[model samples]
Target: MPPKLPPHTADALFFCPSCSTWRRSFTNTNTTNLLRRAHQRRRPASTLAASSHPSPASPTVNGARNVPERFRELYAALQGVRDVAANHVNMSRLQLALRGLEGEKGIVRVAVLGLDNTATTARLVRLLLADPLSEKAEWEDYLQTYRMESSRGLLIRYGEQTNLAVGNSLVPTISIPSRALKTGNLEILVSSLGARSISADQTIASDALLVPTIAIQSTSTGAHSFVRYPVHKSMVCGKGVNGLLAYTGLVGRVNPNTADSIRAAFELNVGEGATPEGNDGISFVDIERAETALDMFRESVQNATEYEKGWTGSGVQPLVDWISSPAKDVAIDPAIKRLVDSTLDGAEKSIVSEEKRKVLALEANTVPEEVRMALHETVSAWAERAHTELRDSLDQGFASKPWRTLAWWKLFWHVDDVGMITSRILRRKWLPEAEKEVVWMGGKIHQAGLLNQETNSTNPIQNSTEFEISEEKSSTFSRNLWPTQIPDTRKQLTTSSVPSLHRFAQNLVMFSLSTTSLSSALSALVYVSTSTTSVYEAGTIATIGLFYSLRRQQKQWDAARGFWEREVREEGRQALKETENVLRSVIHEGGRGIETAPETEARQQIDRARQALSNVK
Candidate 1:
């Protein structure tokens, strides 16, 4: 229509869709050359020299240049160098001091002050190391290795036991609780013997070292010349435990609050302008191309208006108002005019009704009071600026950027009770699903403590039950047996021993069962019950009649005797005495003994055997 507008001239709007900014400077030759050189150094020398350059004939029209060889490789190398730099900055003083304290000085006896009970000590020690991120593995390795060598020189004096063997060591078995406080006496004793003065309050200094298998100098050493591990403070203060536990709980909390604060602040500052494209301008070539295309189109239309002259004989003036009006004279080719009209009509039809523009106007020759009042009310209530600000703030929150921050671990005084901080990281960041596993393990430790606590007390009932006793009609048996029921202590003892076997069978069956839809735990349980029934029958035959004449009466007496001997071996005199007392008491209360008559004797023997089985240790 406009003599087929110039070919080289096209729209060049310089607009960027990502950033919505015009970028013209990036198209310059100097910037392109600099970027090209940066990419070149990353390629191997052979590849760099062998690469072919672009032909001179195939020139770039806008602000775009060919990317140089090895740019991505060079950028990757730079990233590695940055990581090395960051590691150097995070190195601690403990790293430097570790070498001076190795071999002998590092081997100090740790006295866990408040951990009076073995069960408590073991639990606290385990929980401390439960953190995956902590140097827990290292500390645990050190303790296991040191345990063998520690027995010879140490005199463990704690909780009414003194000079305890290292193999049977308790929490206070390594050193006397109060002796470390009165240091001069022990110091003088060791000093007089020419040993190093390493003892301190609540600590026993020893030349006997506790060495970790994988102790790196940088990670293990601390200012006190002791091996240090990371720990989470929150773990110490978590539920169920108290005292030192509560204090240690503070470790993980510090960084969490700080992180939340930083996130909140970042949201406020970066809001909508966070993305690189949104804040920075776009590439130069795209901007130039868009601008050129728009400009060329505009120029073609202007040229057509001034130069073209056409006359149409068709009576279609109403269909084309612009063409009919000479006041807005503009010449268009008949084909171009049809194309333009069709395109406009299609676009108008496609536009949604809600998208159509609207304007308010007072009706002509109508001075209605209600209409005027409604117009004033609508304009006054609208909040144009407030709505825009609210939207801008919301847009920024959604486009939040990723955070980069340093990792910090809290340390505890009781290294064993608190373990290391790395374990905490693994629990929190690496294996959130394994949290129940950690808690369950801790619960097992707690159960062990409860058992140990019960055993150490003076209450005879608690001790006898917690440990084991064997006798017909014992007090322990009476709890489960009816008042009219005769106790069978031998059966109870045999059944108690079967727990280990049952536990083994349980684990085996559980692991063997497949977890497919067709094979479930209940189905596996039924199979185990059906199969293990034979094994239980075999155990009953072997345990009740082995080495005795196949006579049923002899087998019952023999089983009861075996039960008594096993109880005396495992639980010792006190438990045996309690069983004897319960047996005599039951006999005094009118229980019968075996009779000499053959038929009556066997019947009485079975009754006595049943009573023996019920009262087992």
Candidate 2:
């Protein structure tokens, strides 16, 4: 159970720095500290590269360490939560930790796609069997198994005569009487070309593709393991499938200097054709292409395991070696390049007209309406479909998937592709001058230098030695601790003395005001108070007389007070000048200085004075 405070005292308050909104917080102490640290760092939860604008001084990312003890404890605490809540907690921490890792420099963005292996498939089966969330308890009865080799169509048909649609084409209707037996299967039709040779886009005359009947169903042992393979089909450029050439092409594009040497070596091998003398006899492009493909394959495998198995185990080199089975000299394998080219082609088709429209609209916003309207016209038929239909189809296809599972990855990809393009255009056309303005403002603030006076001065503000004065008040408070021993008379005398002193000070000020001559005011008080009687005399006669005489000589006291006040005021002005000078030196030289405790001292002094005055008699 959570802690319970009284209703009146349990009120919660919260705020967000981004929206600058105030609200109630159910967050606890740990949550509060996390927010405070984030504020100090001045970065979003999932940070990107530091903004081009000036960033707040943030702590440098710390090197990775062993798992934290706090996380271990948190993991243990999660056991108490309900199943759904436990999952939520785990997911929350997973995302937070992933964000932290991503924010680090040199960390590449990676998508881990896991293909089901035999061992992993078995584990998945066991988990499914044990799943408390499942409605069916009889596992064997609920499970259905399917063989991959079976010709059973994964399609099912519902009510007949419905209009079937695919990509702007409406097929002619066919009548299916309800009396003609259950779930009709189409007879196998032979074609001159094999199924594998058929293009994916070719239209087949039937509604068979509309319903998928066969699917890999959950079994007691688990679903069958799917083969791990690249989605891209390798396209060999030359006679053989040489990955070296592909790698070289990639390397050449990225690093021409290194590619030159590789190319020279390849030519040298070609010249010494017979047994290739001292050469490996592999083309430079072939060698590099093989290496690149191997590298990509290796990365993909590692990512697959990590994503599917949720494994954080170390020693990845073995997995890499196993995945990247590079063969010797072969033909030009254009697998990677082909994949990239196809993707780029698709993007270009969809993005060209849209990009044009964006640029035009942006320009229109800046130009006169008459000029903007002059440019308006119908886009080509291809351009309209290219810009619209493809986009709509792609969006619909993406929406049909289990998108929630891959939402974060998709969001990250979106940021990389679209956000980066947007930023580049904005910086090129709009932000250069704006950035200069910000820099100018920063320079002026640096130059106008104001110093924090409290950060300097030789004497400590609290005056640790001022304990004697504060101690007196403590003594007075303690004197009344044992009220029975002390007379109440002392308290009465002490209480009256404060008002009397104030009255005396007021009277002296009035007397000084009445007499225009300072000498008359001082002489009258000095003579009367000192010459009066032995009531003013004591063993500490000189000190006692000095105190009383100074008290009575209002005119001299006033003159000295005014003189010292003016002198201190001038000293303060000088101190400020000195402070500003020091600040300028620190700013230029990057010298460090300690903060002065003036405010702390002032507060302490005020407390002490109030206490002392309360006890004054």
Candidate 3:
């Protein structure tokens, strides 16, 4: 460690040039050396566009690699979830992950509508079916939360969504409901006039994640083959289809950029930088969100496989695709008339539609008319029944299926309550600002200037150059960031936001507070409203005032403590490593003034060596 020198001022305020922190004191030698080194290390503006941001090397669209950019668009549209946790579930990498999860000799089928074709479908099938034994956690963490939490609170909150172990096991014998294979699927676009129509809403196609999402299913077949069936006929779009769309829309909003994005949606008007009070900044009316709409559906699926099916995650894509097929208007193809007629000829339950049979009868001049009549009656009766079944499933296909399978995610969990969890995790947390060039931007808060104490009037905070910091000075948690870009919230992050840790943030804050102080305030508030006697009332009032003061003091202490901890963790000794690099850059680059002390001494030694050599001659 560099020798620790006392700062010039009792609370010297300087951004540690080496560590990127506001320090109370700096060793003069270290400070000078750090500034000199930082200056040298600074790259040209073009090359160092992201230097202001931490962890610049990490990917921006953090989902699965080689997936279409549409997945990124979906993550972009989400609420509190940042890119850090946004792994593209059906991207090429996700396919690799699935293969790894299934291991050798595994045959699991995932259906992605028109996107699956004569060529790629077989290859994609092969990729997932190759393995069923190898275990992989990254897939689960990215696609769904597989491991259950011991905490009852977390379990209940995420139980339905988490119980599926899609990333762990793949059994080829698992029975896939035949009805699931053929029915209950519907197209998302109304203008989808036929199979080849491309006039679907572009806005919905881009923002709604379901457009390209995959539906995974476990099959009972031993052979690993993909079936690309023709699309169905009942295409729809409108309020009738909104139930499923509503769920997908909610998924888009699951991960937000900040609490403001949430508050704005609910139209909650709270002061931006005000001290938090009863349900103020990031306050909630309800503590628990018991969204169990899919409980019955979730339980049944979970019980069967002991693991969740892949279809549960992003199956909307395939579901939408299957329903998009041109409806097979005729239940029985004329080509299959022979098979249908013979199968029904003797059954007591069978009744022939004679008039309809004549209309459907294929003209056979070569065969006697009476023999043709017998064959035609049997085929038409079977066709009529098939038509009726298709008509009956109209409602179930559009509505009920989404509730149990693909669209269930929207209603599976209540995200509004997630805001409360957000409050806890981000309680008084500070975030570094968007990494941009050090330029004077109008209207934007100059975050770095706030840290610089010895301000120059000439600079007027406009020319002021400093790193952006999203400092939360709230009595409780509240702040904003670039609307939807999220990074890991645990460290100096750029975009990926982790709102899942909100509950953890609150628990930490409460754990740090004195119970006595909280109890005093609570007792006073509850008792003050009603009293047994005047003296008792007065005593309660006095306690209220006393506790309020204590809590206020505690808030200040908490903020200060948070600042100090961040400084040490993000900058202090850890910063020493970054500083050393800066120091190296300073010595190595350009004309670092020659080290006169060492150079002069070396020249003198050389001259003395020459004199000694003359004597030897």
Candidate 4:
């Protein structure tokens, strides 16, 4: 304050002491604004707007809204649904229902009973078929229409007329067009059983049974008597008679004497209190008067109307209605539907589980661990025996007579004892025994349905000689581990080693002969050059030198023979060990190979079934 001299400087110091701080704060604010503008410029208009007004959380997201606390329970229930969908029987039922809904043609057989007179039954059938609305002129036209639309038409299977005899082995049936018998399709078939066929135990394939058929009765006293026939229990779907139709045209002419008998018969055949005097029965006049009743019956079938309680009418209505009801409505009750659904679900799951078990069983190794171990032991035993035989043969060969040991000339063409013994043990004993075991194992696999047909058909184990024929042939024909390498190993162990050993022996003999010849020549030269050398001394020296040379050659021959024997023994042992290993590996691989294809197919089928179930669910 004291140093302030200029007026402007003094004003500046008083008004803005923290000018730099204020300037820095202003610059920071401006930079922040610039950055905000730049960010806004980089973003799209839609994005910027969206950022400003954040979108609401989705209903399904994290189960934010309208989600039950135990929603997982619904998922569990759905899992069982897949099992139900996989059931074939349930699916077939559903298919049938769908077909019914689509109005597909299906058989509806009806059997008529009660009337003794076939003429009366035939007249009743004609009346049932006659349309009340059609005139006389249109009768032929209506018949033609009915014939053309066979699905909506009726075929009568009257006794004696259609040769549909009572108690016949074959149930009379009218054949439908072949086209209606397509896969997953059906056809309509309407037929009737005669009055003579009606009995307590009479069975018919008809869907419904019509009984107490209309007939005119003649009596001596100018009165009428109605005869009632017993209905078979099999034909009856539910309790009591479905519906009743009484002939009211001759009601006034009823005989008082037979009235009790007719009423008793009606109650016995149908049910108690099912007479015209009772409120439970329905009566209709015969001929043209019954046209209205028949039309009403036909209408009830089309409408699928339920019967009224205590109301009786012609049985045609209820019988036709029952026959024409959709399968879903009549066959599939709610409680039964639930039971079938549950059963189907259980069956589907069981099938899938069973298939999976089959696949698992197939995937498992066919050969038991103990069996494999035993096979390995057997192979080892074979090898041990071969080694023993080889060692014995070599020992015997070396320890044979001197003449045989010295028969070097035989080495040129003849096989050595070691080679012959090794070959014999391999081909005749080891190979045959091992092959038999392998073949037995293969047979077990084949019986299990796991063996590859190609490999089984071309097995080289059966023909042991085939392994030694040619390397190329062996390679081409051989698939098994044992036989594949047998030829090469046999050649290496026998053919290859024997010739080399023979050559070594031949070379040893030649070297010994050359040394003897050289020694003899030197002795001759020494004898000729020495003046004081006596004949006895010369002869003694030559004999000593010859004996020493013979001794050295014998030592060399013995050493060579021992070496050759050791080599052959070691080679044979090694070959056997290798063969043992191959056999073991073959057993292991063969066990796994058994039923491999079938197992894989089973797994694939299970997967496909599971996928289908999932889709159905």
Poorest 10 consecutive residues by lDDT, candidate 1: 186-195
**Which digits, one per residue and each the tens of the lDDT, describe model 2 over residues 441-547?**
32432332212111222322233443212333323312332111112222332345323433444455455334334444455556567766343332234454445
Residue-level error in angstroms, candidate 2, position 28: 41
**Could you give me the TM-score of model 1 versus the true structure?**
0.12
Question: All candidates' TM-scores?
Answer: 0.12, 0.18, 0.14, 0.37
Error of 3 at 510 (Å): 4.5
lDDT of each: 0.24, 0.26, 0.25, 0.36
C-alpha lDDT of residue 75 in model 3: 20
Per-candidate alpha-carbon RMSD to the true structure? 50.1, 36.1, 46.7, 29.4
- Residue pairs with colliding backbones in model 4 are 106-187, 106-188, 107-189, 450-594, 450-595
User: For model 1, what is the C-alpha lDDT against the true structure?
Assistant: 0.24
Error in Å for residue 37 of model 3: 82
Q: Model 1, residue 461: what's the lDDT?
A: 33
- Taking the tens digit of each residue's C-alpha lDDT, what string does model 4 give over 1-617? 01222443222221111000011122377775764564344322212122232222211212212223333222223323333434422332222222122122222223333222223333333443443343332322332233211121132321112222112111112322222122213222222223334443444321122112211112223222221211111121111232222222222233222221121101112332222334213222132223344445445644223222122333333322222333453422222222223333434555666667766764563545566566656666766665666566556555556325344444433324534543454454333343444445445434433333222222233244322334343332235523434345556656776566556666655665676677677777777899787667666656766677666656765676567557755655555555554454344444442233233333344355334333321
Q: What is the lDDT of residue 596 in candidate 2?
A: 21
lDDT of 1 at 322: 18
Model 4 TM-score on a 0 to 1 scale: 0.37
Better of 1 and 3 by lDDT: 3
